[model samples]
Target: MLILLNILSGVALLVWGTHIVRTGILRVFGAELRRVLGRSANSRLRAFGAGLCVTSLVQSSNATAVLASSFAAQGLLLLAPGLAIMLGADVGTALMARVLTFDLSWLSPILLLGGVVLFLTCKQNRAGQIGRAVIGLGLILLALHLIVEAAQPVMQGEGIKVLFGTLTGDSMLDTLVGAAFAMLSYSSLAAILLTATLAASGVISLKVAVCLVVGANLGSGFLAAIGTLGQNAAGRRLALGSLFFKLAGALLVLPFAPYIARGLSFLIANPRESVVTFHLLYNTLRCLASMPLIDAVARLCHRMLPDRADANPELRPLYLDPGALSTPTLALANAAREALRIGDIIRTMLDNVLELMRTNNAEQARATIRLDDDVDQLYTAVKIYLARISREQLDEADSRRWTDIITLTINLEHAGDIVERVVTNIQEKKILHRLQFSPAGLGELEDLHARVVANLQLGLSVFLNSDLKSAERLLAEKERFRDLERSYSYLHLDRLAGQSQRSLETSALHLDIISDLKRLNSLFCSTAYPVLDAAGALRDTRLRRRVLDATYGKDAA
Candidate 1:
């Protein structure tokens, strides 16, 4: 029971440890990664390099592979580049395996302590991400220690030797076993480590052990299969493509098992050499088999996972394609599209909300509420798209720009949320009391709305054109909106004292509406910040902070 518990505990730790590392790396450079990958054109060689470099930095090719699957799922990356990246990620894994071979115990504890402190104390930025990266690296080293210790007993036990022998004795059976085994860990790294240990123990022939490793490649695709569940047509196709790649690799290599064996045989005297040879052979074979026919594989994935009966039809920016990181120009384009989409939704919401404020008709408010779904949906799509982007490969300039986008999107979403919330409040107040505002109060609202609408329009232009000049003008005007709201806020309270009870209530309503408008302008200004940052604006911490605080609010959960 204790042994089983230890194994199970080790299993849980592996999952947690893997998550820690993946999330930490994402924190360190997620935005920049997405920018680069989302922007890459059809340059297969660049895609390969991106995959190798990104996974190498990330310290986990499985995470990178999962990222590619997400892009495919979102219709961002096609099969060719995705496959090329997969090949590169495999090569990247070999790099990580080599890193693991080094005894880094001396640094692991120090890294863990430092990472925990940074993660706890710092604000959200690249610095905070670095803390997470350190902690994840430390945890990974620790998890490896536990796993290696647990495997020691098996290495010495005759039962363990026999179990491994049975697995390797038959190529077909062992391949299935290996595939299942690797899939269980959700990591080819863990699978490779196990194989290396088995080899070092001399529990089985090199040929049999290599066969298990081969099987483990396909095993890693198990999660890809599970990912297809509850996803849309495009998402399913991407997931299926991942599975097919692994299975196809398995099928192709199984036939040439002898060739694979021959390659590893040359390294018998050197275990390190054997490990290297096995890694090279497995990835090389997998890549060669998949490369020329990547498009065909993509087409098959499409056919297998057909479109759903009632798919939500919209242009969603699947932003996280790692191939994009290889091309900053293309990433910039994708970001433009996503920003445009957000701007369009907010603009439309504002237009209808204005109608509600003017006419005071329930129908107008109903229409405004109806548009809320579109805003919410687009928000979800953009957030996920950004999350999928690979950040490690970005240059320093791009990294800053990418982080700015994250802030921009959050501001946009908050802007929309404020609009939605105030609109709902207005609708509720109207439905309950049916109070009409005085002409002066309505005029105040119209003036506030006009300024906010103007800011939104200018901010959209600033974002699309990368125009800091327009953005600066908009930022100044955004400050002027504060003056507008202050005038409105004071005027409404004074007038409410003379008005009838319903009129008094309407004045209060006008004050709230003007406040919300002020906030919307604040968000719009921040939204423009990313474009300015991308365009090389002088960084202003106070200006950025004031608006960001208004948008997220100090009390925001």
Candidate 2:
């Protein structure tokens, strides 16, 4: 019982160390890693290389898989490159496994001591994150030593020998046991390392270790698939494609496991070196051989998991992933993307309103008003998703971005309400009453509507990119839109004074539509205020300098 407890403690420590390392690395270099993956989509080889490099740094292929799936969900990456990246990630993890098996037991304590000191001194900066990763690496080394020390005594028992006797001749059972270990531990690298340690200690034979390695790879595929179960079709497709590759590799290797293990044992005298070398060679050869078939596997995955055409997609929040809530940066990015979706819906609503005004399609008008409900639903989802993210985890910049996302979502929801109201007024006062504006008044409304749409596009651009020039232009358009609204209102009154029949009948509706458009424009332009204020381009108020000086002394003002 004590022996079993020690082994369990060692395994738990190993798992916890890897978790610390993965999260620390992600927090320190998440955005750059994402950018690397994003830019690598142009070619399969480049994407593979990027994945290999990133997974090497992250120390977990599963993390790479999640990043690729997230990009695929956002439609930023295609399936072929995503599969290629997963293949490379497999190779990378295999290499890391080989590297970690080295006899570096002496360096673990030095790392732990230095890491703790650095982490305590600077707990919130990039250096601290580096220290955190260092601490994790030390824990990993220490856990490995502990596992080896604890396992030797337990494996010598008669019960352990009898249990291992069953796995010697059965490749399938060995593979399953290996896969179960990987899945249970949530780290294939750890599983592979434990298998290598067992083999080195003479607890497991060479053939069993090789088969277990193959099974561990397949288990990682299962992990990726299970992790992305809640994601969209695109993400699920990426996972499925990775699983296919892993499954195919496993099928090819399992039948020849005994023969391969014999050949490896003959060439490499050390059992531990043989196991790690086989893992590396298996992944490298499999990934290279499977590279050309990425397109075929991707196509098959797409066919298997085709895009789901939701009955009401607009009512759902597409980019607000719940899994990302633990990573504040990723959560913020997801929220920002969902907020942009709201902007697109608002743009569509405005376009529909214009079309209804032009053709007076009452049925279409009713359909357009329903879009607001979708906006409201999406807005509520984004709000709740952002709210779920723990603010304490966010840095200063990420906190600011969090504020921007929520603020934009709020403005968009209000804009949706205004559009609904405008559509309702047009439906009741104009369409039902069979009233039309004068030709000149109608032309003026169309012109203003076009400008509002243009500004909306610009505002969304500013919100996404935060370009100072674009933000300044968005603010400038606000003033221009206000001027046009005032001018259009005067023109509507002029037409009313001339006793134009159509203008008289729809006089109230015309001004109301104009006012609504102005309000919508204001809401859209609200995205610029934060950008300008952050850049120090915005004044405190619209009051003139002379008026401020008159109210207070120059220094006070």
Candidate 3:
């Protein structure tokens, strides 16, 4: 019972350690990884190589698959290249398995000590993230050592020997057991290493170990498929391609497992070494052989899961990934990305309103109004998703980021409402009432609308990139926009005083439009506040106190 407990504990430690390492590496180098994946892989070989490099660094093929899936889901990469990346990721994992099996028992203590110190000292910086990976590596090594030591006693037991004897080189059954272990452990690497350890200890035969390794690969594919359950069709297609590749590779290799085991036995004396070598060679050959077939597999996957004709492209939440919720930083990043999408939606709405103001097209105005529903849906989705994230799990910076995202989304929702009202007002007052502004008043309103759009674009950029210069520029534009609104208001009143037929007919509507646009500009400019505040550039007073004091002095005079 104690021995069993130790073995289970070791397995748990290995899984947890791998999780730490994956998340740590992602938090540190996620943007770079996305950039690397985002680059146009002009050739299959380049895509494959990129995948191999990224998976090796992150130490998980599943993570690579998820990244690739995200890229594909967003239409950033073609399905063929995405599948190619997954193939390379498999080879990368196999390579890591071989590298990790070496005698590194002496390094575990040093890594743990150094990693803990660095992580504790700088918990949120790059060094701390590196320390996190180091600690995970140390834990993995320690777990392996524990597994080996625990296996020895278990191997010696008559009961274990009797249990193992049931295999009798049944490749299919052994594969199933191995896959189960992989899924249960959530780490095929652990499963393969454990299988090799058992084989080395003579608890399992070499043939069974070979089959188990193949099964572990298949299990990883299964895990990827399951992981993408909540993802989009494109993401699911990429996962399906990966899963099929693994299935094909395993099916192709299983028939020769007996012969391969026999061949490996003569070339290698140690069963563990033989198992590891076979895993390496099998993945290398299988993945390399399948490189040319990526396009074909992608096509097949596309056929299996064709694009939906009825899908509403605008209504879906592009980045609200449930899987990301496990990692608070990543989840926040996803939510922020979705918030940016909302900004884009608002940008479109603003553009549509500008067109309606000029064209007086009621149909287009109604269409723009309907788009506001998309904005509202997305805002609600982002809010709910962020709410699901545990505040306790977030650090100070991430907590601030969470607040920023919530604030940005709130502002965006308000902007969308204001835009809908603007569009609705245009449809009713301008199109229905057949009212037209005076030529000068119309030109002023259009100019103000153009500046409002420019500020919104800058504000969205500032919010997304957190660029201080852009934030400053956005604030400047905000001030200019306010001046323009005041000037336009006065221009409309002058036209009203002139008794111009058009201006008098549209006087109330023109004033309302100016006020509404001012409100919209305020919401768009709000994106800059958090950025400037973070940089200590924002003053406590949002009102321009000096300008206000001058205005009050003039009024007094």
Candidate 4:
């Protein structure tokens, strides 16, 4: 009973350690990892390499899959490359298993002590995150050491001997047991390592261990499929494709299990070494062999789980998958992408309104209002989705990003409302009354509307990429828009004084429309302030000190 307790406790420790390592690495390098994966989408080999590197660094293939799945869900990556990444991740985990089996037992205590010190001293910074990873590594190694020691006594028990006697070299039964261990442990590396230890202790045959290792790989694929259940169609497709690869590989290799086991047993005398070596060889070959089939699998998965476009795509929160909330960085990325969609919806509304102003078309105006409804729904959904994310789990930078996404979505929502009102006012006052602006007034409004659209585009760019130069340009445009709006208002009043029929009849609508455009520009340009302020490039006051000085000099004169 005590031996069983130790083994179960060790498995629990291993799982907890893996969780710590994954979260710690993500917190420290999430954005960089994202960029790396994003840029590697040009080819399959590059994607594969990226997956291997990322999984090795984070110590979890599941983490890599989650990232790839999230990217697929958001249309940031394609299916073929995503599957290639999964294959690479499998090889990477196997490589780590091989590395961990080395003789580094002495470093565990030192890492634990140092990791604890750094984590306690700087719990909120990068240093502390690295320390957290180190502590997790130490715990994993300690757990492995404990599992091995505990298994030896358990192997000696009469009940264990009887149980082992029943399963004498049954490949199918052993394979199932191995998969169960992997699923229960939540770490295939831990499961495979424990299996190797069991084989080394003569508690299991080498042939059974081989079957178990293959089963562990199959179990990981099952785990990925389960994890992606809450994801969108694209994400589910990626998971399903990877699962297919695993299943195909497992089936193809099953018939050869006995022959391969016999051959490996002859090549390696030590049972533990043979099991680990077979694991390394099997995964590397299977993944490499399966790489070319990714495209085929992707097609099959897509056919199996076709994309279900929402009836109202714009009205829905497309990228805010609940599966991503467990990973704050991934969740934030999804939110940011969805915010861009909101920006696009507002852009469409503004474009429609501008056309209505020019053509006096009620249909155009109604379309703008409909788009506004989409904007409101999406904005509300995004805000609620972001609110559900646990802010305390985020680091400082992520927390700031969270706030930025909320602010941008709110501004876009307000801009949508403004555009709808502008369209309605134009349709009701100008189109209904058969009012037309003077030629000069018409040209000025067209130019202002064009400028507002450009600023909206720039604002979206600034919010999406946080580009400093673009942000500065946006701020400059805000000032220019204010001046232009003021001049247009003055010019319209001049025409009103002259009692020009066109300007007199449309005077109120002209001023109202121009003012609303100015307000829309203000909302669009607000995105730049946060970006610029974060970089220390933003002036505290909008009015330049030089302007204040010049105004004082004029007063003195």
Score residue 212 of candidate 3 by CA lDDT: 92
Rank list by lDDT:
2, 3, 4, 1
Model 2 over residues 452-503: C-alpha lDDT tens digits? 8998999899989999999999889989989989988888888888889989
Best by lDDT: 2
What TM-score, over all chains together, does every model reach?
0.64, 0.91, 0.93, 0.90
Candidate 1 lDDT, 33-123, residue by residue in tens: 6555555527877887787777777766666765666566667777668767766777777667667645676777898899889977863
Instruction: For residues 1-557, write the lDDT of model 4, one tens digit per residue.
Output: 78778877887887888778888888778878878888888999999999989988888787888788878887889999999888989998888888777767788899899999998898877888889999988888887788778888777798877877665567678778877877787778878877787787787777778888988988888888888888778988988988888888778877788888789889998887888898889889988988878888888998999988688677667788776676678789888988998888887787777676667787777777888888889898898889989887777788778878988888888888888888888888888876777888889899999999999999888988999999999999999999999998998898889889988888888899998999899888888876776787846563443332332233312
Question: Of 2 and 4, which scores higher on lDDT?
Answer: 2
Per-residue alpha-carbon lDDT of model 3 for 1-557, expressed as tens digits?
A: 67777878888888888778888888777768767877845667888988988888888888888788877776778888888888888888888888778878888899899999999998867788889999999998888888888877886677767878887668999999889888887778888778887788777889999989999998889988998877778889999999998899998989988999999999999998999999999999999889888888988999998877546777888887777676677688789889989988898998897777777787888889899999999999999999999886566778778888888898889899998988888888889976777778789888888888888888878877989999888888888888888887887778778888998887878888899999888888877766766687745463544322332233312
Global lDDT of each model?
0.67, 0.87, 0.83, 0.83
Worst 10 residues of 1 by lDDT: 320-329
Clash count, one per candidate: 18, 0, 0, 0
Residue pairs of candidate 3 with colliding backbone atoms: none
